[model samples]
Target: MLGAVGGGALLYLSFPPRTLWWLVFPAFALLGIVLHGRRARAGFGYGFLFGLGFLLPLLAWTGTFVGSLPWVVLSAFEAMFIGAAGAGIAVVSRMPAAPVWAAAVWIAGEALRGRVPFGGLPWGRVGFGQPDGPLLPLAAIGGEPLLSFAAVLAGLAVGDLVRRLVLRQGPRLLVAPALVAVLAMAAGPLAALVPATPNGGEDRTVTIAAVQGNVPRLGLDFNAQRRAVLDNHVRATEQLAADAAAGRVPRPDLVIWPENSSDIDPLRNPDAAAQIDRAARAVGVPVLVGTVLRNPDGRTTSNSSLVWEGGTGVVERNDKRRVQPFGEYMPWREFFRLFSSYVDRAGYFVPGQGAGAVDMAGVRVGIAICWEVAFDDLVADSVAAGAEVLAVPSNNATFGLSEMTYQQLAMSRIRAVEHDRPVIVATTSGVSATITRDGAVTASTRQFTPDVLVDRTELRHTTTLATRWRSAPEWVLVALGVLAVGAGIVTRRRAVRRAGRDEDG
Candidate 1:
């Protein structure tokens, strides 16, 4: 039991705002120690403990302002997915090539976790932690699912190797673990062979700027000062324009703003529109303005990114399709309102419809506003629709100095590599950064500070294998895991029947 909890802690440590990614090996190794040879029920108990140990701390930021209930409830829910994986691992622990089956089972759990109970929260995925690890290259070949599988597979294989050696199991048993360990290590070098044009080599390069016009205050109340927030962005863009005029920096072809940079329904509010229009004209380029649009029904709002050009004003728009469940809008509002007064504070926002990409300055830019980047499909679909570069416009001011921003930045970095496209992350409060196609952070800004990051961004029309395959890798891994579990169940039943016959005889 201690091992299970400790293992979970180790896995959590591997995530960013810290770079102890290698800890993932020992973490899952410890989990293997607790789960191996256990019954499904026992495995579930241990897995639940592991989940609590891991997710409680990882998701602590969720409740920073809203209080502990939502955070605890969300973490508890996500942990159950890990617990399910543990049960599956236990069932297949004694099977041939157990490490393979165990890793596949883990992926199956993640796939399920990313899809259910409100389109799922795909944050805290193991692959998101590997932006600084050696296995990062694998993302180019197979995306996050494959990267996660490799991490678990290597760890479990190590655990299996250790167990066999300690038990002095015959040399024959060592072959499977040793072979798997070797293959897993080889995957890194093999993945590196995949082509990555980090600097857009020979491709069209555009000057892109990410503006972080910080909020006047932190917490949920920050959006209340909508005018102040809008002015801050306007002031920052005017500053960028001045810089360009003074030859301090290159003028950007397109500028990106963080989500909720304008919460004041700019389309409906004439004053807000004027402010945004002023910023766009000053920059002399199309500005991707993140704003809220009130629906005609007056009950729901749309979180959208509208392309604002100097003369044209509003050109193209992409409404956020994957809205944050509780924060953006409440589910079973009346039922949840009974638990917390904050329930009503949740917006009545509806999901927007689009390809998740929009034209900005003759370039098709992919937009994954805030939490949308956490999901695989949202970003991929945008790239598939013809986005040459990716942008993540996020508002992390609500979390305030939490690791959430850093963790999210890590996801963008992984996406950069996964799709082989340059990624620009613009946040309302800070930690804004530009990532190259190889997952390297070229430039960044500090949190809670108003700043701007101007960089030469490469636009690539070519897609990586991961982008082309989309969710295929995840589904394939899940299918194999299900098959492995079935085989294990059949094997166990046959053994039980043979034992009963012998006893009767």
Candidate 2:
């Protein structure tokens, strides 16, 4: 049950405003000491249980959007990697090399989990817990995976301190404590030394307007009035336009609408295009409209954000890099159809691939849409691809006023500081946000509300060390961790041979 408790604790802490909950990871990781050197099966059980405990709650957001099935299914699948991690620990820790081998096995597990099933969930990683902590700069050198490994190292250190103290290995126990202190404290100052790069563009600050075309109703049935939903966004932008014109709100250099604002294709449908044109003409600047585009090669569609410039018309675009498995499109259509009919499979939607950024009137914006914000590579690549400001145009209308919106908003905040770029998050059913490079929210809208957030935060043309060097640290850590495991394997075989010789004698 330690797993369940730890999992619940993780779920509570993973959300916005109070991301401190991630600190539970290192504490939960200490459970390894109790289950230490157990059989592989036992270790797997504990790890799986811990994974279930953490994943069940951490992924409740999936249930909030899709249903309990996805939440349970995804949690179970993700927990498998944790089980494998436990098995690795069981094998590695049995050797004389405890500290090095154990840490490597754990880091390897996290890396594996992050990349499975269409590159992996990677949501509740211990590294994310350090968002507000100084160790966050460590992400520049190593990425989140490295930060996660470091957190594990600290946990291992604490466990080692206890073991050495119990054994009365005075100096060794002191060594463990010293290790913990160093890892925990070094999160500051040194993390700043890692390489970073900013999203490119003019460094000057410009007022940005984020339009939330709030849905009239909330749920699957909500999109019944597709035209009404489209009109709401148009109307909200119209209001912001009026506000800007009168100086009630600062005149924005650009406007943003959330993904899927046009249930009915805007480019093809003259009426829908006309409505967008009117809003752009009113706003007097480029408006990024998230829409479903028709691909000629089949009836399949692409979840795309098109730039609808007032005088220029449709200009630049970015297709969502990562699509939600079941939500955006279904996997193994025939196999799953037997289980549930209401699969609401985004059967028509097509996945779009890009380096993660698109251009807007010489301004490069990184687009982190919906679930993509939770991903490290997506935002990191956007900044690396020369995006100046991060724009997350998401559609959370289906999930309503749960913590999902808030949690996603928090991710935007971390990305701001992680890459030192301003982030613009436009959502269909609220939590529209504008964040600064220092990880502060300049302005935000309430959930399920039709509102506009007006902000003039400095748009960063600079990069943090994290942006310039992405995942380089993770590769290095992985190599070192693997080497430790390999050495442990060799040492264990030698120890077994020595024991056999002693028995023969």
Candidate 3:
């Protein structure tokens, strides 16, 4: 128990702290090896504890933003997947040639974990922590799961070797790295494969700016201060314009503001329209502004974005799809509110229709507003519908200074690679970023600050194989994993039948 706890704590130190993410695998695998020697049920218990230990803190960010009740419930729920992975590992380890089956088991666990409990909170899936690690390149070919597999396999191989060295004792210790080397080389192929991502400070670039108009207050009631928020963005854009003219920074092609930058209902309020016009005209080129729009009926609100065509008020526009579950709108509000305070306070933002992509000069901009980024299908839909460059207008100010912003940034990074497009992420409060096609963060702002980070890059018009295939590779991997397990079950059944016949004879 102490060893497991210590190992789990070590795993906590492995990520965001530095490039030590690889340390987590050996810890998990060693915990597996130690527990595998116990009874099946006991083995599951140990694995679950280790999983709980790891996930409880890793996903603390979830509850950290929402509150303790939410944190406790979410951690317990996320920990179940870790427990499930551990249980799967225990079953696969009982078989002969356990290591190969062990890898398969982990993959199966990842797949299962990603789909359960409201489409599963698929955060911290092992592969994400490898953003700066050598394993990052693997995401292009196999997506996240393959990178996860390699990370786990490397650690498992090390743990398995260490166990053998400690208990069995032999020159066999030397052979483990060679086996892993062959596996890693075959998986990544340093010589033959193209790196999925590119190094920063490259040749081509774009001077794009992200504007953060930090809202004065935090709740939905603060929407009454809509003019103030709009002015904040306008003032920030003016600063950028001055910087550009002074030659401190290159002129930005487009200036992006966060969702809900104009909460005064742009269509209904003429004053709001003029405020946006002022900002776009001040910035010069085009400004993508997130605003609240009401249809002529005025029954509900549309969380929509409009493009400022130079001096013209609103040109191209996009209504946000995938309205947030409890944030933008509520689901089963009366029933859900009994459990928490926030359930009752959610927004009334109505979902919009259409692909939500529009033109800015010649760039095909893919827009996923706030909550929409969490859903991969939305991004895939945007790409299919014709969006060469991606722009995310998110308002993270409500969540305060938390990992939610970083997590959202990570999600945007994956979308960039998944679709082979340059992603410009603009957030209110902080962490606005410019992502290249390769999933690199070229520039970003400090949290809760009014600052602009600028980057220039080639806007890729081409789509990636991942975008064309979408989630097909993951489906293929899952199918193959199922077949492998099914084949093992059949082989075991045949052996049992043969033994029964000999006994009868």
Candidate 4:
């Protein structure tokens, strides 16, 4: 149990805003040691303990605004997936090449965790922690699933080797584990050698700007000053225009605003519409204005990203496809309301359809509004739909000064590498950044600051293997895990029958 707790702590240390990504291997190695020969029930209990140790702290930021109740509840729910994964690992531990099977089981657990209850909260995915690690290159090859597989395989191999050494096993016994570890670690650098199509190797460059206008204050009430938030963005863009005119900065081809930058529906409200138009005309470029659109029924709303052209009001628009649960809209509203009054505070936002991409000035830009970035399908759909550059328009003010922004920033970085496209992140309160295809942050803003980041971004039309295959890798891994579990069950049953026959003899 102590070892399991240590393993979870180590895993937590691997995540942002920390760079100890190598710690994940050792963490999982400890977990493997604890669960190797344990019964399924015991494995679950130990794994749950490990999960609590890890998730409670890693997700502490979640309670920054909404209080500790939601945070604890969310952590407890997510930890159950890890507990189930531990049980699966135990079931497959007796199989030949157990490390490989165990690793596949972990991926299977992630697959389930990423899509259950409320479309699965994929925030703590191991792959997201590897943006700065050796396994990062795997994201381009097979996206997050493959990256996670590599991490788990390497970790389990390490655990196997360590266990063998401690037991004074022969060198012959160590060969397979050593080879697996070497291969898993090598896969990352080898995958990195795959030539990335940089900006599609074309001379076309689009100078784009991401505006972080910030809000009046932090917390849930940040949106209370809705008009002020909109004005802040307009003021920032206007400043950028002044800078461009004075030859201080290059004029951008397109400008992007953070999500909820205009909580007041610009299309319906003339005041909001005029403000956006003024900013667009001043910048002399189409502004991707993030706004809330109230439905005719007034019972629901759409979080939309609209392109406000200088002469043409609103042109192209991509509504946010993955509306966040609880934050955007409450699930089991009536049932949950009994537990906390915050349930009613949830928005009436609904998920939007389409590929989450929009065309502006002949440039195809992908949109993953804030929470959408956490989902694999959302980003892949945008890239597959012909997105050359990706934009993550987010509003992180509600979380206050927490690691949520940095953690989310890491996701964008991984996505940049996964799709081999430049990623522009525009946030309402801070950490707005421009990430290149290699997952490097080129420019970023301080938290709670009003700033505009202008960069010459290349448009890449080429797609990586991840974008091409999409969820195929994850599904394949999941299938392998199911087969391993089935084999384990069959093997156990065969042993039982053999024992019964021996008793009869």
Task: Give a tens-digit lDDT track for model 2, residues 4-36.
Answer: 347435534644557574454355445446446
- Once all C-alphas are superposed, what RMSD does model 2 give against the true structure? 2.8
TM-score, every prediction: 0.98, 0.90, 0.84, 0.97
**lDDT scores for all predictions?**
0.91, 0.73, 0.70, 0.91
Those runs of model 3 whose alpha carbons end farther than 4 Å from true positions after fitting are 1-12, 17-19, 34-47, 96-100, 169-178, 185-192, 195-206, 217-224, 294-302, 349-353, 461-463, 484-505
Model 1 lDDT vs. the true structure? 0.91
Please give the range of 10 consecutive residues that has the lowest summed lDDT in model 1.
194-203
For residues 219-312, write the lDDT of model 1, one tens digit per residue. Answer: 9899889899999999999999999989999989999999989998877888999999998989999999999999999888999999999867
Candidate 4 per-residue C-alpha lDDT over 1-505 given as tens digits, one digit per residue, 9 for 90 to 100: 8998899999899998899999999998998989987778888888887888789988898889778999999898899999999888888887889999999999998899889978888988889988899889999999999999999899988998999899999999999999999999999999999865543445478999999999999898999999999999999999999999999999999999999999999888998899999999999999999999998888999999999998689998888887889889999999999888889999999888888999888888999999789999999989878888999999999888988898999999999999999999999998899999899999999999899999999776677888888999999999999899889878878988999999999
Clash count for each candidate, listed in order shown: 0, 12, 7, 0
Off by over 4 Å in 4: 196-203, 500-505
RMSD, every candidate, angstroms:
1.7, 2.8, 4.3, 1.5
Worst 10 residues of 4 by lDDT: 195-204
User: Considering TM-score, which of the candidate structures 1 and 2 is the better prediction for this target?
Assistant: 1
Error of 3 at 408 (Å): 2.8
Name the regions of candidate 1 deviating beyond 4 angstroms.
196-202
